[model samples]
Target: MYATLPSPLGTLYIAASDDAILEVDFRDEAMPPCPPASPLLQAACDQLDAYFHGERQRFDLPLAPRGTPFQQEVWQALQSIPCGEHRSYRDIAALIGNPKAMRAVGMANGRNPVAIIIPCHRVIGAGGKLVGYAGGLERKVWLLQHEAGMADH
Candidate 1:
């Protein structure tokens, strides 16, 4: 099931199965028609709303992002990052016990199906440069700033 909602970045198309969230896409252009939302999708939307409003810092939704094992490891590592903190691609590789796989980690980070919920925006370049967000760099910057503001509370 899926539903779309307006957000700070743009329209968010949230998809889910009966049990877990599948994806959260940033749709600025035309969007395909979405079906009626399932209960899980509604809950995901509510949590996302709380997140964007700075009333919530952490997401508690059950996510079922589809990817390979290595990608899965990278996504799991991404979720471990604190809401207001950032990590380098190299740091994620090291955390996953593949210190030399920074490039591969970058690839996985780029392919993350769920955007903000997975927190892929928290991953930056090795030298602390902002880079590689599927939602575009501007939205990434906004998200980082939003989280930083929330963390101050």
Candidate 2:
């Protein structure tokens, strides 16, 4: 099922299957009505709300994004990035024990189905430039700033 969640940045498109929350895409304000909710959907919404209110730093909700084994490995790598800290894509590839897979790491980060909750936003460029958010670079900047408490609004 799919749903639209009103968020501080914008309306987010949330999708869920029976086992886990699967997607959270930013909408462009022409979003349709939200689909009916499931337990997983409700849980994701609650967690996102907690994050927006600055009451949650880490998300522990169920996520089941579909992708290749390499992508899954990269997504799991993203989970270990601590709140308020950032890492380079090269750094994540090293953590996953594949220093040469940096390109693949960035691709997986872009392909991440779940957004802020899984925290692909925490990965920066080697020289610290923000890059490659499927949700848009500006929103990516906004999320990083918001989490770091450096955002204006």
Candidate 3:
């Protein structure tokens, strides 16, 4: 199932299975149709809305992003990065017990299927500079500033 909603960033595309969310696309040009009242899609939209409005800090919905095992590990580690906080690619590599795999960690982060709900925006360059995001750098900055209470929209 899928749904689309307008957000501060832009229109967002949300997809889900019966039991878990699959993906959230910020760059998909076409918005796919979804059932009028799919509980899963509605729930995902609600949570994301709340997040953008500063009413939510962590997501509670079930997520089932597809990736290789290594990427899965990186995504899981990303979840541990608290809202309003940031980590370097090196930090993520260390958390996954592959401290030397910073570049690999970055590759996995770049490939994250789910965007904000998975919180990949929390990762930054080692020197605290904003780096690449599947979503544009400006959107990434907005997300970070939003989490940091620095952005009102």
| Candidates' C-alpha lDDT | 0.92, 0.87, 0.89
For candidate 1, the per-residue lDDT at 126 reads 70
Q: Which structure is stronger by lDDT: 1 or 2?
A: 1
Error of 2 at 16 (Å): 0.7
Candidate 3 segments exceeding 4 Å error: 28-36, 150-153
Deviation in Å, model 2, residue 28 alpha carbon = 0.9
lDDT for residue 40 in candidate 2, whole number 0-100: 74
| Model 3 / residue 110 / CA error / Å | 0.3
Global lDDT for candidate 1?
A: 0.92
Q: Better model by lDDT, 2 or 3?
A: 3
Query: Which tens-of-lDDT digit does each residue in 45-112 have in candidate 1?
Result: 88898999999888999999999999999999999999999999999999999999999999999999
lDDT of 2: 0.87
Per-residue lDDT over 1-153 for candidate 2, one digit per residue giving the tens place of the 0 to 100 score:
887888888998888888788888888868876744787777788878888888788887788988999999999999998877899999999999999999999999999999898899999998998888988989988888888883333
Tens-place lDDT per residue, model 3, 35-132, is: 42588888889889899999998999899999999999999999999889899999999999999999999999999999998899999997898999
TM-score, cand. 1: 0.95
Best by lDDT: 1
Q: What TM-score, over all chains together, does every model reach?
A: 0.95, 0.92, 0.92
